[model samples]
Target: MSPKASKPLVPAKTDPAAIRNFCIIAHIDHGKSTLADRMLQLTGVVQPRDMKAQYLDRMDIERERGITIKSQAVRMPWEYAGETFAFHMIDTPGHVDFSYEVSRSLAACEGALLLVDAAQGIEAQTLANLYLAMEHELAIIPVLNKIDLPAAMPEKYAEELAHLIGCEPEDVLRVSGKTGEGVDALLDRIVEEIPAPVGQPDAPARAMIFDSVYDTYRGVVTFVRVVDGQLGHREKIQMMSTGVTHELLEIGVSSPEPEATKGLSVGEVGYLITGVKDVRQSKVGDTVTSANKPAEAIIGGYEDPKPMVFSGLFPIDGSDFPVLREALEKLQLNDAALNFEPETSTALGFGFRVGFLGLLHLEITRERLEQEYNLDLISTAPNVVYQVTAEDGEVLTVTNPSEFPEGKILEIREPVVDATIIVPAEYIGAVMELCQSRRGQLEGMDYLSEERVEIRYKMPLAEIVFDFFDQLKSRTKGYASLNWQAEGEQAADLVKVDILLQGDKVDAFSAITHRDHAYAYGVKMASKLKDLIPRQQFEVPIQAAIGSRIIARENIRAIRKDVLSKCYGGDISRKRKLLEKQKEGKKRMKMVGTVEVPQEAFIAALSSDEGNAKEKTKK
Candidate 1:
């Protein structure tokens, strides 16, 4: 350990050949974290008794959800084949939503371990991430994981991966993340197959901030991989992107735990504490170098993230607005993909229109807010950006319904996506039927193997924004996996349908739907609302209308009152007067009766009872 905190933990003269920078890439639930834990145990960095599952997954929410929301980097030393080597392992996220960030950060790695489940064969994300690895020209070593299981089919999956990656099936190494079977071979392969990082230690320090998180006391701590030279403590550094300068307070590496390193040198991955408060200054993919002697060339950064799914997020209590804002800021420090802006809703009042990479990303953000920040939130239905060409020829990109102009639009174009689904051949017809029912156009279909097929469809983004994935899973018995990307834009007959209670539009319950499905959707929405809303003294009309053209209506019948009691000693004229008086009183009460809509109903309106569209089911 260096007392000065400005020196490298290892010698500055350490050889680049001794360091291997690699990341583990796998599809979700394919044992990525489990494998990393095994590596830690094998390296003697953590004892077996002290070891826990998913050791690198540090967040409580991440541990509970069994998902990796972000990437993590760690350094450990190992000796193999009579030579000492240092492994800088990056545990990348397995979700499709975070794949782009992982890809961009892959530039920092010399190679990647492509983990595939033997029983599941090839999946949509497996292929998707494999292509991304190839795009970056990463040395990908296919590892057939879960080989110890009774249902494991390592031989078959090896062939599937080999066919896709153009490698010999025998070259795919088999390992069981659970029982540690053949893990030694996998480790040896990492050192042998993955090349040493190439960098010039004599040159000026140049590092890429692959990930960053905010600490209350430390400000912003950025995780970086040194491309060249060395970074020292108390050194003034400049962010190439923001052109901002700051002092490096501390430098260290996560050896499964944060350990103080004097600084990071060439071919090393570690954390840099720059005392940066605003996360915007320490952006992911930004170049960091010494301010006194900066690098000549700046590292090319990743493209700005584009959020495809849009929804409004509001605190359950309006008084918690400021609290929610602070929570968002803190959360944003860990997630650069989350985009939000303040907006007002007539029905929900003050709130924000938040944008997410996908539906899963939307759900994760909401969960973090509720569980971590302890703030109750209400999120409106998720929607996609629409290009509206007005009657007067003006064009607008509408994300929120409140932003819609009052006039009739000549054309409204919604976003479309290229979706690839991989499932067993038996379920092909079911998936095809579901896609077609959602107005999907078949793009291509090909046989990956005798019993497996890949089905590609071009479908409107709005169609799958809510229940499509759920339906696909149910239809295929959870065997189907999907990957989607935005395919430019397409024209559609779209209308914004508003839910009216007592003839007043509720903006929070409004949604844009295709005109062809408006009748059925409207009828279902009106019916669902009628059931959710409590009955009042007067009959309340729950109607779904398209710009005042009522398409579906459901009425909540008023409770009948037997107000006339037996007239013991009164004549027929007295009974008539009593009935007339009771009728007048009923009319007065009807005028004053108010329908109080509960918070649950507003949140429930975001998705249908069939499936959760706005939120992902907790897996």
Candidate 2:
């Protein structure tokens, strides 16, 4: 749910050229949000006492985690050179996982404040987003922040950033977002450097929906950027892509609070209420235009996002399926990128095959489900979409291992990605070794500066989904930044390895791994499962198999009863009789014993044995 507030609207100065639309871009903890707070404070959009840390981040999860999961747009009035300038600012996330959020935020703006930490220099996310901004043809104003810190060396970092982005180091602006220094000059530079919004105001209304959230009282509150014409209150509007129409209820902008306005024109960023109940009707990237006088062409860049990772989400109680479905429906209303459909596992019963942009996105969705709805859930191991080609040239995309076809005539093509890592020169060797161990092919290496290097590699999406980031952090001492993008598909020698509990294949515990390394992984996984699964009354055999070939096996020892505990010293006949009786009882129990695998066991068995087992063995 959106943690938003409603307030009165102070009409913004609507002249398109007098308005500047921009967003703050930086690395995580590189002062993106802090700089936004300073800007809001300086412009008097938020009072000093009313201002708090991460004032733009309204979500409790966002503030507690010190990250921006959602992009926030606000309008502020600031006077410079005897004229009041209206600034439409977007505060974007700085993490690689939320790169899509940053992209959407940038899509709404004509310029971006390219913030770089004065002490940390530049990072992976910083470069990734800088490239994104360049792709959007947005003007970037380089700003060095956190100069108040003792470790800050603005001149040195400025040169580094200028060298990478190909700008003059002297042109870089310096600021202390924490201390509110150099903020005013930065605002002045935005006007002089960033271009004004360019669009035909007399044309049909064309506002791009950049972000949205479902409100408990208002339904879908779509955040939009007005590129052409204007949205009038009580006018019938149409979604350019969906062709669905809705009556406009109200229009407004965010001033860190939702404010109602009569109408919004070109160069304005605001939210709209259409009285629409379905969130899917108003999606990000969809264009809102006048129904009566629709535009000739739909706004560009409205394609749906592809899910990078997929997993099974099952309710612990089978009766809770309806409740789980309702919860997912509500969550998906706000998160358009989230995809799910009904799926069933032999062991997990009925569930949903949920797809997410990345691992972190999946993690956040699950936490919200459990926390917001108070439901118990189990998630299977994450996997990526695989292309399975038959001899007849029939290609099918598969995300679940249980759904992987047998005797599918031809090769399996797995998604591959072009990965980039930025690290200190000293740790280059270690980082390269770690990447190589994950089956990454070294593409190239560049010396960004005397002390930093940028390494590029081609890696399988499966490897990236499973512990690659954690392993990289371990090797680089958390000093390296990694970024990746899908690079189509490649043929691979892959196999589905299934884990069997007491001779029964547990579909939820299966995974796809490289054929050559499957046996070793199978062995590690079998042993790990043995440790995780509780001891049953009878021995439970844990096995990993590829097709009918069993690659590895382990057994969970049974809980043996000391029947002789009550026996007196050396009564051989009595001891023998008791042992025979116990043996008979064990045989009977073994024939009827059904090992119940715990939920945690399924999670542990399907995972790569990193910390729980000898991860070095895989190397």
Candidate 3:
């Protein structure tokens, strides 16, 4: 027999007159998902026994990663001001990489529950999202979460919210998502404060697709906010992107509980059943209009964000190329943030130069590709956008090494980033030192609390492209949180450093370097490349050069005696088999005439270990 399910604490249904459509927005780990889970339980949408930490993050990878990667919707009926109403709650992603996804979720709602950590207070991302909500004209309801913690400072946070977001201090609701303290009051405020979405239900079916994900069994499951009309199951719908029409196989409103009702109406947030198998077909930010009477096109439905960082992602093993490509394709079907193309590497092998929103985004994508898809990949170092002035007086955006200007350029500009870091007050000195070490200029600092400070800095996007966070975490004992935004371009004396392994330039290992650190960086790169490239039949020269000047060079001595010293007599087939295997392996190596350059030589050239080790030695 199956285990008995627990009964919901609150009644299943309440008066529908008090309904409110709102979403919870916060920086990562600020308790948005947890608060949603608590609200669902309090509203009887989910039972107490069935409660999970982040129920909205149903994806296995999300649960393991402890981050909400996608936006999730749920409905709950509650009572407020002597009236019953349905509350459609959307839980949005906090990371800036998913800013587009968050915007889509906000478009579906009329109000937002901005969750701020009581102890940590407002962060850069929190402020950014608040501005986004204001741009959308959504009613912002500030909530101070984690009030039950010993370090909680609800009053201070309330004041900050009022000052930062222009919301009244008294209007900020203090609630503990952990202990459920003051949670019901928040629910009541939601119904009282948030306005009901106004729209006619009889108009032609017009829905906005805020987000979409691919399902193996369900095809494309699109989350939409019905804007103008009522949609019914089996109704024909036209997607704005491809103009391909598809019928709604199913229509349903999501609840914290699985047994919720189906078929949602106007002003309600729910899912549509597009029989289309590809998620890309139902692009997020597209419009779904009635096939019979489509209205004047949905304006600004979805605008693709330009990728700011680019890098090559290749399989560690040549044989895994096919599997890696399949994995990326599958990931793209679910994540619109990831973009890539087929690319070739002289040292690393076949791969794709994938573009991402930011450094964090790149890391998350790489981690997901490896963990979810079970593929091993070699990633090129991340690169920021560079403005190159050509000899013809035309400015070009160069992201890849191949696109860089080949002639003497007039000037080179790199993208600068405004970075904000929050850390414990005791670690302020260390954090400052760390930032300065990365060529960062201190902007300003603010004391968030007696023991915590938020430091602002202007840094080159190229500085933090690698494991800067790891260094910060180590220095601050994992207490520092970083947030940054592109701050346009800055004139820099920068040069493209081309790395050559076995005399041939490895484009994937190339980088834009500051003139001050060119020599050091070149030596470090050459050393690393020497380690990554395997020994071949001939000695390989690893060189790093800026234009015509060679700054650093390392050599991998040829295998002085790779030839077999002795051969067993009469075992001609065994000897032949060994020789053929060696020959095939040698053929895989890129040959510059008689010289065979192994793949490892290319990878070592890009490793950060060489630079890190040199820095340690200098210290």
User: How does each model score on TM-score?
Assistant: 0.93, 0.92, 0.83
How do the residues 1-619 of candidate 2 rate in per-residue lDDT, one tens digit apiece? 2333464444633989888999999988998889999989988878888989989887767876888888889999878788887799999988777788888888899999899999989887888899999999999999999999999999889999899878999988999999999999999998888888988889998999999888888799999999999887788999988899999887887777777777898899988898788898898899999999998776785456788999899987889899999999998887878889999988888999999989888878888888888877778888999988877888878899887877744899999999999899999889888888788999999987789888999999999987899888888898898888889999999999988887788888788889988998789878887877789887788999998889999988888899999987986999999989988887798788888876666655544444642432222
- TM value for model 2: 0.92
lDDT of 3 by residue, 1-619 (tens): 1112362222222222345889989999899988987888898977877877888898777898899888888878787667678889989999877787788788888999999999878876787788789888998888999998899988988987887777688888999998889999998888778888876666776788887878787687888877777666677889866789988776666775333233556687777777688888888888888888875657363567668789888887789889888898888888887889888866667889898988767878888888887876667788888999988899998878767888878888888888889887899999999899888999999986576687999999888877787899899888888877779888989888888766677677788888897888889777765665567665678889988778899987766444455774767787777778776665455364344444454444444556643443333
Best by lDDT: 2
lDDT score of residue 251 within candidate 1? 81
Q: Candidate 2 overall Cα lDDT vs. reference?
A: 0.86
Model 1 pairs in collision: 7-262, 466-613
- Candidate 1 vs candidate 3: which has greater TM-score? 1
**Per-residue lDDT value at 178 in model 3:** 86
Q: Residue 413 in candidate 3 has what lDDT?
A: 89
